[model samples]
Target: MEFHSQQPIHPTIRKCIQHLDVIKADDKTKQIVYMYMESLLRERDLIAASKQEPIESQIHN
Candidate 1:
């Protein structure tokens, strides 16, 4: 679930998420927004971690 990219995000993903964010105005929509944001952040964190050398993998087992 990790993406490895040091450069700027692709326009497609950014725009899609932005659109999703903008579409909701109600409480139910807020729930959707919360889910979307959390997912996006988790994925972004995984991507960043993937880019770095994992500490566990570096040490001899």
Candidate 2:
């Protein structure tokens, strides 16, 4: 279920996750963190997919 080991994230994003005081964050704050992580995963997947495709195909599209 871990997406982190398979994908790389920006240093700032890592720092934010590392520094987050889970015990102190309210429900809303935790939800925001979850959303951010989801977005980051989607962006990483999109970038990886783009790299896998041929440049000619991309140019023609």
The prediction achieving the highest TM-score against the true structure is 2
Per-model clash counts, in order, read 0, 0
Q: Give the TM-score of candidate 2.
A: 0.55
Cα RMSD for candidates in order: 8.6, 5.2
- Candidate 2 residue-wise lDDT, 1-61, digit = tens: 1234565755665556555654566556755785687698789999999899987878854
Give the lDDT of residue 2 in candidate 2: 20
Candidate 1 lDDT tens digits, 8-40: 545555565566567745556545655576678
Assess each prediction's global lDDT (C-alpha) against the native.
Answer: 0.62, 0.67
**Error at 5, model 2, angstroms:** 20
Tell me which residue pairs clash in candidate 1. Answer: none
Model 2, which residues run further than 4 Å from truth?
A: 1-22
Q: Estimate each model's TM-score.
A: 0.46, 0.55
Cα lDDT of model 2 overall?
0.67
- For lDDT, the strongest prediction is 2
